[model samples]
Target: MKLLEPPVSDYSTVFWDATREERLLLPYSGDRPFWYPRAVAPAHLDGDGEVDWRPAAGTGEVYAVTVVHRPGPGRAAEDGPYAVALVELAEGVRMLTNVVGCPPEDVVVGMPVRVCWHELSDGRKLPMFTPA
Candidate 1:
């Protein structure tokens, strides 16, 4: 299926690049932490723009989730009653993604999940969560 989204720019480019590369990217400014990409470190209020990008452990647990029986626009092939889960990575960042590899009814809160790559029609890979 073709999922469409706008191209990322600015500090968030690193995130899109990492997703295409099938890796998890985390942003760090010195000792401070950040997510979703920003021009400066939110903790120290530093505009140094000295962010560092690094790979993160893709292992995580399903913090919470819900099954979408009715697919939304452009998500028709996602299968009825598919799970959308809030995955809490080992780094403590929680990202919402689709949980695959099993029936949606079988998924439960706090279940173990791992990052997996789903290839798009354009050859870019996106991250998804699956049973660990």
Candidate 2:
């Protein structure tokens, strides 16, 4: 089965580019960092809509996790038993990513993880996490 590609767009070019270099860049408005890069910062921020990109520490802990046994459309069932997790980064941001490089059943909440990359067929790297 073909792997899914990331949702890259004008507002997210920086993020996609960083992954290619093995870097994790998060978008910031003043001191507040947010995910899913967009044209403007979080609505609560009073600063101008402009944003800045910052290098992430690339370390986090599994805030939550689940093992997927069934694949969605276009995906293969043999890819079952993969771990999907909400990783709470040291920077205070939570990211939805897959926990790999280890057995799916072994992933647990509060387990430490570090950034890893999966190269895509289109020459872009997708960021995932592995036990630190």
- Steric overlap count per candidate: 0, 0
Off by over 4 Å in 1: 41-50
The C-alpha lDDT values of all candidates are 0.77, 0.87
lDDT of 2 by residue, 1-132 (tens): 245676778988888887888999999989888876778987877768789999999999999999878865445787776888999999998999889999999999999999998898767788899999
Predicted model with the maximum TM-score: 2
lDDT of 1 by residue, 1-132 (tens): 444544556877777777887987878777555665666666554647678887888889998999887775567664466788888888777787888999988889999988998877656667888899
**Residue 12 lDDT, candidate 2, scale 0-100:** 82
lDDT of 1 at 51: 82
Candidates' TM-scores? 0.80, 0.92
User: In lDDT terms, how accurate is model 1?
Assistant: 0.77
